[model samples]
Target: MIKRLVLLAVFVGGILFTSSSQNIVMDKSNVEFRVANLGANTVKGKFTGMTGNVTFDPKNIAKASFDVCIDATSINTRMKKRDTALKGPKYFDIARYPEICFASKTVSRTGMNYKVIGSLSMHGVKKEVEIIFNSSRNTLTGKLKVNRLDYKIGPKSGVFVGKQVDITITCVVE
Candidate 1:
């Protein structure tokens, strides 16, 4: 009889742990990027709109998953001309692909943080990527580097624009 009680308690505890996952708070989240332009000059920008759902439970890391989308048309660099060019065919082509998305397939612990293996889709191209992030309470912060040419984001001869882009993301889960 004592063994049965202990087994029941453990099963209930497992359920409670998994149910602790939360949804992401979009208004409090941010996604931004940095890249180099001509003359080794740097340009920084951000996407103004984002929506996503997050299921995160540190104790149950295997069940955690993230499916997020950012508005491609919301790219802003504080410069009207540059923003316009970024939405054109040579860059994001927002008219054709209006959203950039990431959906996680697996989540695993890495040291004190976590690593998520996921599929990132942008500009009509999809690629597998790894995202490393740290979580504390309801907040998460992470960064990843990607090459623009891998997604056909820019011209093959990117002499004026750098091929590598660094991206950062921060969010609060409710």
Candidate 2:
């Protein structure tokens, strides 16, 4: 029993020493999002407000953790009328759900990026999704494209705007 206990303690200590944790560092100047109206050459709008954190251990991705949030009201399509409409119940419903969030449950390293399995909550609904992201000391960027309809997001179009929306987030790892 003593030998086993000692071995286990050493193993746990080694893991803690090998892994590193990081925090989310937004550039504040480099955050944006674009939404389209489909088939139209014109892209609808963009969003501004953003904040989050990312913890990682490249050598040990299993030790990684992440949480991100975006301000729903910050959405801007260059038109106040359209932006306001987006915040309504038909779309984001900002009053009922002011923030879109993600919390990672597991992290696995694959190729050049890490695959994160997490719960994404938006408009008062939560779903599991995977986010592929690359993390380095200089910068960490994550790009995940998910359909609004998957989260029961409003009456975009029965035609299906590709059934997937592209989302990309870039931030510094602190």
Number of the top-ranking candidate, with TM-score as the measure: 1
Task: Provide TM-scores for the models.
Answer: 0.86, 0.75
Q: For residues 1-174, could you state the per-residue lDDT of candidate 1 as single tens digits?
A: 999999999999867755665566767887889988884798999985678778888888877899888889999999999999999999999999999999999999999999999999999999999999999877888889999999999877668888898999987777
Clashing pairs in 2: 45-77
> Per-model C-alpha lDDT, please?
0.87, 0.71
Worst 10 residues of 1 by lDDT: 17-26
How do the residues 1-174 of candidate 2 rate in per-residue lDDT, one tens digit apiece?
Answer: 999999999998766644645554544413354445654543445555557766676766666777778787888767888778879988889999998888899988889887888999998889998878787654767777777887878675845243456776666655
How much does candidate 1 score in TM-score? 0.86
Where model 1 places Cα greater than 4 Å from the true spot, the runs are 1-21
Error of 2 at 86 (Å): 0.9
